[model samples]
Target: MAYENVEVIKRLFQRLFRDEFPNLAPAERQAFEAQLEGRIEGLLRGAAGDGKPTDFAGIIGLGPEGVQPFEDINYPRIKPDFDDSVIPTQLHAVAELYYIWQHEQMKIFQVIDVLRRLFQLGQLRIQRGPGARGLYILEKWKPLRYSRRDRMIAYRRAFNYGTTPAPAGAVVNNNFHFQLVAFMSAFAQYFRDLMISEVIKGGVALSERPFGSAATIQRLGLDLRYALDRASYGNILALTTETGQYLREILELLDTPDIKRSFDANTKWDVVEQVSQRHLGGQAELSQRAKMAESGRRALEYIAANDFSTTLDISVFHAEGKALAQHAEAWIAAYRMTAEGRRFPGVERQLRWALGVGERTARQRLTA
Candidate 1:
């Protein structure tokens, strides 16, 4: 599957570049293909391990020795109730979402905290230029130092779909995957913060003093701009293209007649609810899943509408942020009830502290 994924990526790049440079000379095209293959090979070699499955326990900081292979950790098996030809594919998609949610819960919060601190320290300024409402201008920008091991863990979590290990080098050398994830994290924060600002202000404010005096919008703008500048146009196009495809696949699975019948679901959203409760966590609720599903669909439509343009649509951003924030908040509550959260109580406490929420308020929010 790892090799298949690499091949898929190669095909995507080939199609993208071919369309863009349809008039390339035969010799030039040959050289381009050769260089692309070499670059892909180099990425594979740069990762730390040979192409072997990673240890499950070790990757998540459980222990030195791996108790199980990463590939062994999978979504719950659907019972053999009906035609299940697409079950494996559906489960794979859900597992990817699970992986992303697990990491995003931690990483996205870290980004928010960083921006919150910068705001408190007066390091972020509100943008007052024309057409910059509810936006900020970062006073200074610094790349967050994410360790190689951490990056490898994230890579494996997202890409280790088959028995084979994912490439470690794929996360190294500021590769496209790394940049894509970074942009996503930043974007999530931007939207999440925008939601918070809107909630605090109760609507769009006429004043330019700063919406809720938050630094998220500003930092998000800078971070996105920085990511765009660093990444190639091809990389951006590929990212959007792949993301849209995955979203469509997931949505299709949710709406598939066979899947709905297998789960005895009444509506497409019911499938989401069932999957979330069974595989995501015990606390996964119907309402939360609904929000996530709706926002996901909206996101897919937004990507389709934008067509790979890096343009900011504030209204769309705010709407997405609002829905995603609600989902994240619910997810956090659910995660706290999980075994992992029980083992690491400080995680929530640290987040609460960073967000300047008192214990009472945190408890109230969780219970609410």
Candidate 2:
């Protein structure tokens, strides 16, 4: 019970697209990890400011006043389980959910909205050109929206988009690889919304029709909303966070040039608002991670196993930050091209890919 929150964050990361991110120079990647730690510290020490009710924010952490309250508060000690079985489960739930979301949100005009959410999430990547001179886009996505009708619709749709069989050339060929840990990390936290509630009901000898957040709403035909604490809150957030990141990654592997154009076109929102969001999402939850694993993210996770919400917080922060960074990188890489469709390095010509880009366009960019 005490370790519930930490479990949430761990599961969130396990569901991410970490395999493709190793593209950075080893040193650069190390540096990226380092920066992630500082961010981790800020994230876990959440937004409950000076002289405020401690319970108001998601988690209560050592404030800028710089003091760990280990003495004043009795830490709830619990060991977390980051098992392997969780990965496949997380992937299945999210993949299913995404199939549902697409059915609902992908209007002719809103395809751009869906794609933009994915691009901004930095979960997936796009093929722009070849190697060093080649560029790729990060697939970032927004969290999926859930409503009673949407959930029912999703159930009806399933993950099989069997409406039309497209020609082989029309579909982008992508072998989207994900790190095992990222995969499990997400499942350990998120699937609870769709599964563990039943487990809890069984444990408590309650009804099969368990009540969630919108219990009082007539939508689900529920009677009352149940009370939740660190565990459930962290679980939903982590699951949503992981799925959002995944959507971003998938989008990147797409060569939706028009979508890319739209993101660039929205240059009006101001740097502070835009860049800050790109680099600093989910920080409230993730920053507290100790400087472990290059950044404090996994490191903080190492120390705060007993503090469930804190662990979940840092994980959520990391997922959001990574997605935003990847999206920004992918979008910017588009501009770093030439008429011949080549970037700066010879690698582009060699890879001959467009991970998310259309093939001919990807070739032009790579050759440029």
Candidate 3:
């Protein structure tokens, strides 16, 4: 009863689609299922070339080969004195915090503010404004999309936890990192849903208003539209995980005496400014992180003062959290399997690409 068994995989897929996309029409659901089935078949064929039996295990490279050394694999070069640099030594932790704020575009606070505005006004307007198609719409609250490569780059910058070359002072802490990712991914889903609900509740009826049709503007283009429509179901898990880990790292780094002593600060905000100036560049006054921190404080206060029990379903949040954790566990297992020699021709490439590694000039090898 391996997790990747075809039947198990099919069942999970079915449940995920049904649970996440309850609004889809029956025909549309079936069409999407058919497309998924086609992908599964293609994957199976790729894993089992030469007419071999294509069980899930075999596809993941767990046939008789078992685990073998990747002796031929080349590892990325490490700079001998990379960690000795002053900037990396004192500023790595704060840099991580800055990265999280900038990379995520302050999504948590943005979502909270949107919800706050919607509930306070009893209704929020989302009509398309002047732009190519339209801009500053409610749908912009969805998570920003990043390729696997981009995600991996972020990982390297923050925690230096993969095959890619990390910043000079990149450090790794596997258990902490994984936990952080898991928590963040779950919260991302939670906040995303809240934002979506508020937007729909406030904007759905506005379609009948004088300029209501403008609310349907495809300003973000089709890809973003599709992502928003689906509530970013495909990649929300990954995004949250990335955000969570960075946040945890930032906190942990800041707690260290070395980092604390480096800054002559009366408060944590001063520490933030010092690090931002030295490592991240830009003045703290005009920095995006500064704006996010200020707004985020206000949003939190609003949430604390308001009652949102009707909109915030703890049960649903728990269920989504469990799903995200399970998804992350399975993907991590698959990554390990692929790294440990259960690889097919393109399997390794695809996995590495998705994880944002193995893109360097020399073929990068995975290490445990």
Candidate 4:
């Protein structure tokens, strides 16, 4: 399905580029289109399918040449050292895996860049601040991650972002607000691993007797290892992208004495308290949903209808929900700090509705 979307996008790009680059000679235009097609297909081939490599380097666009579809072709392993047993074969395996992952990520970024260009988003006033932007991303992703009612709730929050404001003493906390998207986006793409990692980290506990079995334990260990590696890859991808600058800026903000003081020692306690309450509330809602279904078949139907993962995996849902809430809070606080918070302009509301709640909400959340 995603491959189909890419194909559609490629077609659109070809059409748009032809119109935009009319000055190019016929041969030059044809060559450029070929280049674009080649790059997109190569990247897709390189991307990992189901947590395993496609065994292709998947290098997108221009780079150092002679990088084989598999890294082993470029960096063949040396023979095993029977005597000293130094520089083992496992090291080569690890290296090859790393390179393949890197190249796949490179392709993801490249594709993202192409979309950004197509959207012409650079012309927009994205500098409105992190709070607004965070809200914007939440709105954008809600459709991708939620169902009808859930998505509508997200839409309301996005709407509120444009018109809400921080209370007198409340902090907008842009540091937390802006970087939310980058982390959440990365997490969304790698949530299976994130769930596994949470289990391994003691953040989520298993109650079943199966977990006590040696086979189960061994399988869990392997899963945890893979989750850790995948999480690392996701983090690296997030931190290196353009939005990742927000993550860097967040750290830099903490370096300021006054800004650092804004977060009291009780912040951790508050966060934990909020998370616990929200998790319980979510569980209650889930139970209510189950009752509404009233039967096994209906429950399956409900799950099928829902756009988001309705997995019994509470840990993953909690993490995702919390991130969504955080972005919403940040956006609201920032909106409140601005003039738009006092009384939202009706025209703006209409415009927001037309643009989709997320876009309007994000725009409204901008600092005055």
Identify the candidate with maximal TM-score. Answer: 1
Candidate 3 lDDT by residue in tens digits, 105-181: 32333322333344346443322322101112223542334544565554444434456654454343222233222
What is the total number of backbone clashes in candidate 1?
3
Cα deviation of 92, candidate 1, in Å: 22
The C-alpha lDDT values of all candidates are 0.40, 0.31, 0.37, 0.33
The model with the greater TM-score, 2 or 3, is 3
TM accuracy, model 4: 0.17
- Deviation of model 1 at 304, angstroms: 13
How well is each residue in 1-368 modelled by candidate 4, as lDDT tens digits? 23444456568766877676678864465466556666765544443232342233434413345443433222221333322222222222222323222222223222222322322454322334442343344346531222223322221221122234433443222222122222222223233344566678776443321212222222322332232232222122322232334323322322333322322324322322233343323112222222221221221121122223211234444443444334333433333333333442322232232223355465776433
Clash count, one per candidate? 3, 68, 2, 4
* Tens digits of per-residue lDDT for model 2, 1-368: 12343345445444432653467664365455556655544433332131233331223554544443534332243234432113333333433343324322322113334334544565324334321011222222223444334343322332222333333333211211111112222322233343465476665222233332212111111000011111122133344354455445433423334333433533322221232345434111111111111221221122122222322333343354343333223322331342222442332232332133545876777678
The clash number for model 2 is 68
lDDT of 1 by residue, 56-160 (tens): 555575766546454433322223422212222322333333333333332322332343344456553423432122112221332223433443343343333
C-alpha TM-score for every candidate: 0.28, 0.17, 0.23, 0.17
Stretches of model 4 off by over 4 angstroms after superposition: 1-307, 310-319, 339-342, 345-354, 357-368
When 1 and 4 are scored with TM-score, the better candidate is 1
Deviation in angstroms for 362 in model 4? 17
Query: After aligning candidate 4 to the native by TM-score, how far in Å is the CA of 175 from where it should be?
Result: 24
Write down the worst ten-residue block by lDDT for model 1: 130-139
Indicate the TM-score of model 3.
0.23
Candidate 3 global lDDT:
0.37
